[model samples]
Target: MIEFVLNGRPQKLDQVDPNLSILEWLRTKMRLTGTKEGCASGDCGACTVIIGTPDQSGKFQHEAVNSCISLIGSLHGKQLITIEAFRQEPGHPVQQTMMEQHGAQCGFCTPGIVMSLVALHASGQPDASSERAILEALSGNLCRCTGYRPIVAAGREALVQAWSPDDETHPAACLVQEKRALEATLSTGVGLSLPDGPRYDAPQTLDELRKLRGRFPEARLIAGGTDLALEITQQLKTLEHMISVERIPELSGCRVEGDELVIGAATTYRRFHRPISDRWPAFDGMLSRLGSLQIRNRGTVGGNIGNASPIGDMPPPLIALGATLVLDGPDGERRLPLEAFFLGYRKTDLQPGEFIHSVRVPMAQPGQRLFIYKVSKRLDDDISAVLGAFQLTLDGNEVVACRLAFGGMAATPARALAAETALCGQPWTEASVARAIAALASDFQPLSDVRASAGYRLQVAGNLLRRALLASDPRHNDEPMLVTDYA
Candidate 1:
């Protein structure tokens, strides 16, 4: 049976459709209509909900996630909170501010917005009141009828208010006890079999996961389910047998091992933010723009790499950083460069029984300059039209070594060996940058898509390289090169 806490109450289910999403279960089974579904594909955040999971300190850490694309099976040992949890009588801060600031009109998207703000408040982050922080928190929720002005105002007001989590009556406080109980049950491991011939298994250790993989070779491996869930929600495909790697201790966190950052395959982007930003400061802005806060909270780096999409945002930067992947299977473990994992469009080198174990990124060295630029249609929660990641190691003015990787410029996220060779021994100047720009034409011949034309993709790719060169040069230190730095 699958167990979880819903609205401060413990819930257990012995039979359920493994393909059912949290949104679907809420509205269909529980008849909780407060969580509305807009775009079932997770683009629109009308189905946003808060999920509370225990952190290392045994305190509940709340995060907002897109419910429509989140499978019900994934809520095994966590707290699933919906908009119905808040009451109108004892009004919550988010609801009160929404009414005081006139944040709702037609009220179709108010619940999701309120849930997002609630998550922001529950985080207790020091910068929750800042306009940028509030905007980042609400980036996933879209208000079509009422503009964002009043909603942003409500967010600003609600965040500044004092919230006491210690209150015995508060949901957060109540969930603490319930979460502990739920975790205790989860310690035995979870294996659910539905009447409809679908099974979901969550293994706690690497040995259990390896055995499960061997036993069910055709079973799909899931971690975070940000991309995998789309098979059910968007394409209407049901996953019969699934093995979850998220619960495995060996595949759920990151650590610094010597000169490399060793990140587990199931590590979510939210967990990866600090370590990646600490190592490469330039990645902060680009990583935030990769997806909405909701997506980042649930999306895993390994899933992004394994998906093998030509325009996947993380691959270009990871490739440029010279990252390596560790894969495990019946034959034991093997290591290979990240770039070599992608075989073709939507294809990877993973064998039938092999799975990505972890990724190792080398630490940045002195005199190494790195630039990551993502050109997308929208500033937030959008796919890239062209993402350019450049890393250069310079000996004085001349470039000793460099790596230029671009996504959305080819069939796979690949390096521009031709362009890198052009700047290997050249001076790090406008002249050398121009030469590399010219060589990029020979490196890639992109296709025309709805996001951008092939010519525009090529043009932007070169311009991004030039922007990196200008931003890296000491002569242009005072100039604003990044979009966030402009204002």
Candidate 2:
């Protein structure tokens, strides 16, 4: 049985298909059809919903998530709020402000927009007035009919003026309290056994997960399912036997150990963003635009590396930052440099049954400067065409040392050794920058894929290094270059 709190009610599902999507379950089984299915594959923002879960402090936190591709099994122990609940409630700030701002045109994406706004408002972060904050909050939601101006206005209004004195008595809040009372209702103490002969195991400890992996080496291991679930929705594949390590308490925590950050493999970007970005400000900026709030809410940095996508944004920065990955299996734990984890296209150094347990990153030391550039067709919530990460240390006017890594340039996210060699020990000047840029040709022979051409990738890699050099120049505090504004 799958149990969760749905709009102040304890909802349970018996004999449910383990592969059924959350969107399908909500629209078909529950007969609550307010959530639209604009895109079946997690894009288009038509199927966004709010998920409330207990934070580390045991406080309930609301997050907007894409339900179209999210599996029903993923919502097993959380509070789910839909547009229907908001509609029934009298003058919820999101609904009232959306109406006052005239934020709905065709009304197809309005529910998702309102729900995403509600999540942002409920996040305890101050109502976002900044354009970037609003954009980051609504990045997952797309409205073709209602231009973003009104939607952003509504979001501001919801934050600024939408709350009522009676809101404490609202259904959602009552549901929160109810969910707290029913916290032990989750059947997590035992491994889940489906009636259809498929099983989904949720392990709460590293030893339990290790034993499970040792037992079922063939079982598909899942953390966030942000990428693995795509195999089901896009390629039409069924993950029969699965082990989910998301519930493991240790694997979902991040901490500062000495000068390095030890982040659990299952730690979401949202949880590690502040500590990580605090160490690397440029990295922080790239993360804000990495994906929509929904994607960031669940997407894990360790998962991104484990997925081994050449175009993933996280790997490039991790590689450039001299990060290491910890992999554990029946053979016990082994550590490897981040770059060595990727061997070829879609291939990794991970042995059978070995899964990534955690990632360790050395914090930025003094005189060390970092720059990350993500070149995507869209400014936010899009895949990267060319991503670059550079970590440099300068000695007066000389380039004492540097590390340059580029994604979407080769079969794997590899460092530009030739470029790094050319820049090291050279004077930090335009001449040295030009030489380093020229050496980029020898570093990579990129492919002409849909995202970018070989020549385009080569050129962008060099251009990104040039921008890094310019941005690192402390002689002037000039603004960094914007790829969108490039003529």
Candidate 3:
């Protein structure tokens, strides 16, 4: 049985299929159809909902998640706030403000827009820069009818009247309760055993998961359903056995140990945003632009690396930062460097029954300059044509060390060893930059695709390296410039 609090009401179910998505459960089963389904694979945000979870500061944090791709089995004992549950008595402050700001047009996308605003408001962060954050939060949501001007204005208005932290519920309390329930259920060996074979089962411990993997060697292991949901919804493929690893507490925390940042396998990208953003301001821009708020809320960093998509946004940074992957199977645990984790396009080094347990990235030393650039047809919510990460260390006038990593340049995200070799000991100058650009051709034979032609990709990849070099030189690119809106 799966039980949860849906919009201030406690609900329980007995005969629910584990493969059922939260969107399907709400729309088809419960008849709460306010959350629309647009671009059902999670790119579009028509199915946005506010999910309340605990933050690092031990406070209730609300964030937007795409319900369309979120499996119902994943919501065991959690609180789910849909469009129908924003407020009971009257319209919420965000909704009222949107109406006041004339934000709705055609009104098809209003529900998602409001849910995203509610999440932003719940964060208790109010600033003029929040306008951009709000826009970024809704980037996955397409509003063809409205120009997005009014919606942005509505977000600003909501910020002015944002709720106090005291008004929010205690998510930690809910977590404790859910944890107890989960423990009791696990003690009873309760699982989603269905008639057509077990498609999904969320074990509570690593031992149980390992045993299940041993019994069914071909079972699919899922952490975040961001990628697997496509197989179920688009491909219409049915797996005989599916196991979710999110419920395992051992695989869901981020901690710093000595000189390494150890991130658990199931840690969501949104959870790492604040700490990472504080440490690396350059990464703040890239991380914020990774995906819409909904996708970020549910997607995990481990899932991103495990999927082994060449166009994934996080791999280039992980590779540049010298991250390592920790994998565990029936034979114990072994660790591998991030560079060796990917074998080819959509392929990895994991053996059968072995899964990635965590990722560890070493702390950056001083005097190391880091830069990442993403070139896509659209600025937000689009796959990259070329994603680049550059890290360099200089001693006096000579390059001491360098790491150049890129995505969309080959079948997998990889470091350009040849280019790095050319740049490492050379003088940090225009001539050295030209030599590094020349080495790129020998390093990668990029292919032509709808996203970009081979020629355009090669040009952009070289220019990105030059731009990174320029951006790293504080004496050249650090000066403040004035900006004005012309009449």
Candidate 4:
């Protein structure tokens, strides 16, 4: 049995097929079709919906989630708010603002855009940085018809006219309480059955997850469905057994441990965004552009490392930061350095029955600089051409140590060993940067693909390294050295 709240109402699913995506379940099962499915894959944000979960502090935090690729079973014990549930009457404050600002056209994408705004409003980050914040929040949603001027205006207006605490509110609070009670009543602590041969299980504890996996060794351990959902929707493959790690409290927190930041395997990218972006401001911009906001809310760092995709975005930075991964298996737990974890393309040192439990990133020392860059065709909703990450420790006038890692330039997101070797002990100068660029070819033979030609990738990867060097130099002007104006 699986229980959750849908649009301010208690909901239950017993014989519902677990393999069905929330988008499918909403349209077919529940007859709630406000959430559109533009791209069955995770790219388009037409299926965006607001999901409210209890944070570590036990407060309800709402974030926009992609419903098309999201598994229905994953919605257990959470509050799901759809566009239809937002206002009691025809016009909510947000809806009225969008109307007043003329933000809607090709209304299919409006629901998603509105939900993203709802999430931003609920986040309580304030509107001091409203335009950039709204742009970043709505970046996942695409509105080809509208040039985004009115939508941005609407977002700003909504922020300006947001309701105070004393204003009359919707009845979602009562519904939330009632739904929580319903979930408690249906607490069987087991898996849900789906159509076809596949079975879906969500375990709340490590022992329970281990036992479930032990019973079904072929079962796939799913953290974020970002990658695995493609197996179902695109490939049309049915999983016999899937165990979601989202409910495991032990595997879902980011905490600090003596000079290291330990991130749980099940922690979503959204959960890590603030703290991580705060430490590395460049990452703040990258995090917003990582994918659609839906992907970040649903995807996890563990899923990225566990999948071991050559073009995976996070691995290069984590490897450059000297991170380590902890794996939990039936035998016990073991730790391995991130650099040593990847064995080959689509391969890792992870053994059968061994799952990634957490990743530990060592804190950087004083004067150490970390730079990450991703080159792609478009800034939003595109795969990387060549992604590079570098960590440099400067000894006054000399380079003490340098770690360089790149994705899409090799079979795996591995360190550019030869390039790092060239940069170490050399002065941080243009001559040293050129030597590192020349050594890139020795480290990896990049392939030509739809994203980029072989020569272009090599050139961009080299340029990224040089950009890192320039960005780190104190003598360089902090003012915008590079600027472009668009009509």
Candidate 5:
């Protein structure tokens, strides 16, 4: 049986569909219709909910996630707080301000918006009230009638007068105690299996995961289920058997090992953000635009790489950084470069019964410079049309070494070998940049797709190279170069 705390009460389920989503269970089975579903594909935030997991101190750390795409089986040993939880003796501060500021009209999106704000307020982060922070927090939520002006105002005010779980009598405190008890009762490697339906297995240790993978070679491996869930929700594909690697301690978290940043394969993007941005400051804007805050809370870097989509955003940057992966299987572990992992469109080099264990990124040297750019239709919560990542190390004004990688420009996220060769040993100037831009024609012949035409993709790729050159030039030292700088 799977156990969790729902609305400060313990909930246990022994027989449930493994492919069921949290949103479906809440609105259908539990008859809690407060959480509405607008875009079942996880684009619209009408199904937003707060997931609270106990931190080291036994206090809950809350994060907003999309209930529509998150599997119900993934909620084991955690607290699921839906919109119904806010209907207490005293309403939440966000609800009060939202009412006072007229932040709802038609009220279809209000529940999700309020839940997002509640998670932000409950976080107690110092910058949660800032204008940029508030806007980012609500990026996933779409309000057609009420507009964002009043909703933003409500968020700002609510943050100033927000209430936190401070004492023992608080409802959150009781939920925390209940969560601790539930976690203690959960056995390691707890999973859900239905005789007539699908099967979900969660392994807690590396050995357990390896053994499961060897036993069930046909089972799909899942982490955050951000991408895999779409098959079930959108395409109506039934994943009969699945193994979850998120609970494996050896496959989660990040650490600095000597001169490299070693990150577990199951580490969520939200957890890897700080460490990566700290090492390569150019990644801050691109990483934030990878998806909305809700997606990042549940999406993992390993999943992004494993998907092997030609236009996947993370691979381009990671390839330019010369990152490597550690894959674990029945025969033990093997290491491979990130670029070599992809063989073709939607194809990877992963063997049967093998899974990505971790990723290692080398630290930048003193004179090394990195530039990353994402070109998309929308600035936020959109897929990339072209993502360019360039890394260069110069000896004075001459380029000693360089790596140029582009996505959405080829069958796979591959390096522009022809362009990199043109830039190597050349002076860092507009003239040399033009040569590299010309070489791009030889490097890639991107295909036309719904996101962009082939000509547009090629043009954007060249322009991005020029932008990188300008960013590294001394003449443009005072100019704002990065997307985050303008924001």
Candidate 6:
């Protein structure tokens, strides 16, 4: 049975459809209609919900996530907080500010906005009133009526206002109790077996996961269910047997061993954010643009690489950094370069009953340079049109080595062999960079899609390389490439 806490109440779920999404369970089964479903595919935030899970520091953490695409089976051993938990009629902090600031015109998107703001406050983070923090917190939410001005104002007001009140059941007090209640439930291990055909199994250890994979080779393995759950919700496909390795202690770890960073497969992007910023600061900007804070909270880096999406954010960086993958199966384990993991679009080198265990990335030497750039129409919560990752080592005025990789340019995120060859022994000059940019065309013939045309993608790839060159050149350190580039 799937046991969880629902708004300070203990709830046990069984005899429910394993394919049922959290949205369906909330709106239909529970008759709690506060959570609305705007875009069932997770684009609109009308169905946003807050889930309480332990953060990287092993403390209870609250995050806002899309409930439309999240499955009921995935809610095991966690706390589900919804809009119904708050009595807005009594002037809850978020609801009061939202109402006073005229944040809700249509009221359809209000619930999500309230929960999103609550999550930001619940994080115990400083400077939640900043414009950047408010924008990031509400990036996934769409309020067409208010035009986001009032909503943003309300978010700031919530942060600026003193939450103290005479009532014990006020929003602040309730939030404090919520965290304590959720932490109390964390000791409960996850294992849900439905009575019907479909079943959900969550293994706590790596050995148990390998055995489960061997026994149920046909079971669909899930890490975060960010993209995979769409198969059930959007495609209407039934996942009869499901196994998740999310809580496996071994797969969720990140450590450094002998000048190399070893990241477990189930490591979430949010957990890896600080480490990457401390170790490889170049990726910090691109990482922030990977997805919204909600998506990053639940989405895993290994999940991104495992899906083999051409536009995935992790592969290009791994390819450029010369990373390797470790896949373990019933027979044994094997290691290979990240480039070789993908054979084609949506195809991988994973054998039957085998899964990626961890990834090894070679740390940057003192003089090595790293660059990653992503291009999209919107800044946040949008897929990439083109993304590039490059690592270069120069010896005085000459290039000692170069490794380049790109996404959204081909069937798989792979290396640019011709581009790398062009810069291998060339001088670190504009002419050498131009030659290398020209070599990129021979490396990829990208397909045109809604995001960009084939010509635009190819040209953008070259322009990105040019930007990297200008940024890396020592002579251009004091100059700004763009007009708004102020430091």
What are the per-model numbers of colliding residue pairs? 0, 0, 0, 1, 0, 0
For all predicted structures, in order, the TM-scores are 0.96, 0.95, 0.90, 0.93, 0.96, 0.93
lDDT per residue for candidate 4 within 138-175, as digits (tens), equals 87898879649988888888776544433446323322
C-alpha lDDT (0 to 100) for residue 2 of candidate 5: 79
- Model 6: pairs clashing at backbone N, Cα or C within 3 Å: none
Misplaced by over 4 Å in model 3 are 54-59, 87-89, 126-129, 162-190, 475-487
lDDT for each residue of candidate 1 in 1-487, tens digit (9 for 90 to 100)? 7888888788898777777899999999999999999988777789999998876567787899999998887887888888888863565688988999999998998999999998898888999988999999989888888569999999899889865766866543533443457657668678677776899988888888888888888898988888889999889898999888888888888999999999999999999999988988877888788789999999998889888999998888889989999999888999999999999999899987788899999899998877888887677888888889988898888899999999999999999999999999999989999999999999999999888888988888889888987787567762322332111
Better of 3 and 5 by lDDT: 5
lDDT tens digits, residue span 1-487, model 6: 6777788787987767777889899999998899998977777788889987755455556788889878887787677899998865575678888888888988998998888998887776788888899998998888878559888898898887655424466665544333454454444445555575788877767788999999988888887788888898789898888888887887886899999899999998888877766777777877787777777877887899999999998899889999999999898889999999999999999999998898998888966888888888777777888888888898887889989999999999988899989998998888988999899989999998888889988988888788888887667652221111111
What is the lDDT for 103 in model 5?
94
Candidate 5 has its poorest 10 consecutive residues by lDDT at 478-487
- Per-residue lDDT of model 2, residues 123-171, tens digit only: 6665465566777888888888757898888778677643432467653
Best by lDDT: 5
Give the alpha carbon lDDT tens digit for every residue of 361-477 in model 3: 777787776788888777667778888888788887688998899999999999988899999899998899899999999889999988888888787889888887676677767
**lDDT (Cα atoms) of all candidates against the true structure:** 0.86, 0.80, 0.76, 0.79, 0.87, 0.82
Q: After superposition, how far is residue 405 of candidate 6 from its true place, in Å?
A: 0.3
lDDT assessment of candidate 3: 0.76
TM-score of 4: 0.93
Which residue pairs collide in model 1, if any? Answer: none
Q: For candidate 4, list the clashing residue pairs, or say none.
A: 18-194
Scored by lDDT, model 2 comes in at 0.80
Candidate 1: regions farther than 4 A off = 170-178, 475-487
By TM-score, the better pick of 3 and 5 is: 5
What range of 10 consecutive residues in model 4 has the weakest lDDT sum? 478-487
